[model samples]
Target: MALLTYTPEIAEARDKGHPIVALESTIITHGMPWPQNRDMARQVEADIRAAGAIPATIAVMDGEILIGLSAGQLDRLAQTQDALKLSRADLAIALATGRTGATTVAATMICAQLAGIEVFATGGIGGVHRGAELSFDISADLQELAQTRVTVVAAGAKAILDLPKTLEVLETLGVPVIAYGQDALPAFWSRDSGLKAPLRMDAPAQIAASHRMRARLGLPGGQLVANPIPAADELPSAMLSPLIETALSEAAAQGISAKGVTPFLLRRIFELTDGASLAANIALVRNNARLAAEIARALA
Candidate 1:
């Protein structure tokens, strides 16, 4: 049905076998406020270009999965209040209904692989949420990583999640979690999670080579690159832990759950931090985009 549509830039890049980094669109539609969301999306795309790769910001709209968004499309998406935050489960339904939707980490990896793009960058991936034992509120992103063949680069699982459980689940699923240039895993918005990484790679080439090796071994899934946020931009984990606890308590009391949990917590934390959380979020996303572009280039 010609469901995959590409903008001219991405189409050209694909034709020429150039590196392309796939970006998820929820960051545009749900991650930030309008003008700021648009601005962040543009800056991240620019960072990818500056790093010598094309950026493919993926979303589903008008019965098609767009591999890349043009400036106008990006602007429209940034302001789309009703867009679905799609994951592996609902992506096809959104497309089938001709509904505009923003891609999350899982959906982005799926679309990226379909487009033959190998790398994706996001601020952080969803994971086992805190208190998942009772609620079973784990995110689909981890499962997607265990099946999709697109390497995802991010700071780590969002700090609001149960990081240790997230790492354990990733390990159980055979997803390789590699820390970039560090031994400790990074928490989103922070440079370190204080948890030692299962693996570490000092260079993008090394990561790319591992990706190729996995293919050679007939591996089914992709790699997770835990790229740390730059030191200057990190919100220290110590400073954030108490605030996170407070936010979680509030969410529990207010009965926020399911897909609504993460965003609600993020919003509350944003308030608790007096806007610092969002600023840190923007920085880490840019950092991840730059690294994803490098990994894409290495793979190309």
Candidate 2:
């Protein structure tokens, strides 16, 4: 039996050569709560459609990699309590065991490439954790970008991470971090991270052209398009920094580590901010989906 299964919509899109954007399932399974997660997933898929592309929200279930999910499947995933958070390390294990799993940024990239889809949209990419110098905890998302061929469009590295270390590691790995229409890298929910981006591209077509050029040159990795959150939707870095620090402190005191750290910090920050963080996250994800759709159209 094949390891991959495509939803009818995605299969049709592939057969017709329609532009398609890949979406990570973690945002639905692990990022938000029940109804809201389902709502956000639907909204993001709609945003891609509105921008002239099809959305392939990737997940794993019943020993198969699902390139896209139906509405019922999305709902079930959003409500499932024990979905494994599959990354590069354990994606195949989850597949072999037929466990339901949400694809993280790294897993999504691998699955997207396997499906021959070259663009993925997500709220943010994971990166070096704040205390990573001691913990040595870097995200596989960074390593995945260093080798995968699917271009990722994200607000930026999740703000709870150490942005400088993340950028340094990406630079060391030779991954192109291109800030879209901006000089500074975006800080997930914030429009600016105060760190200058190494590369910048203002248009979707330009991004697509660069992706093609990389393929022409036989590059091993994909480009990271740091699409800033819309100005109106952003939580200023100044306002968000203190909340992030508080969340980080709480997580450290609680002994949270590994994958648990992100969810804990995000949930804590959302509570500390009175839910503004999740609202901004939803906005940024939709924004990224729109841009990824445009880039996918250009690639097509």
Model 1 per-residue lDDT tens digits across residues 1-300: 897999999999999999999999988887888798999999999999999999999999876899998888888888888999899899989988899999999999999999999999999999999999999999999999999998999999999999999999999999999999999999998889999999999999999999999999999999999999999989999999999999999999999999899888888998999999999999999999999999999999
In model 2, the number of clashes is 0
Please identify model 2 stretches exceeding 4 Å from their true place.
none
Candidate 2 lDDT over residue span 42-125, tens digit each: 999999999999999999987789999998889889999999999999999998888999999999999999999999999999
Q: What is the lDDT of residue 121 in candidate 2?
A: 99
Per-candidate TM-score against the hidden true structure: 0.99, 0.99
Candidate 1, after superposition: displacement of residue 8 in Å?
A: 0.8
Quality of model 1 by C-alpha lDDT: 0.94
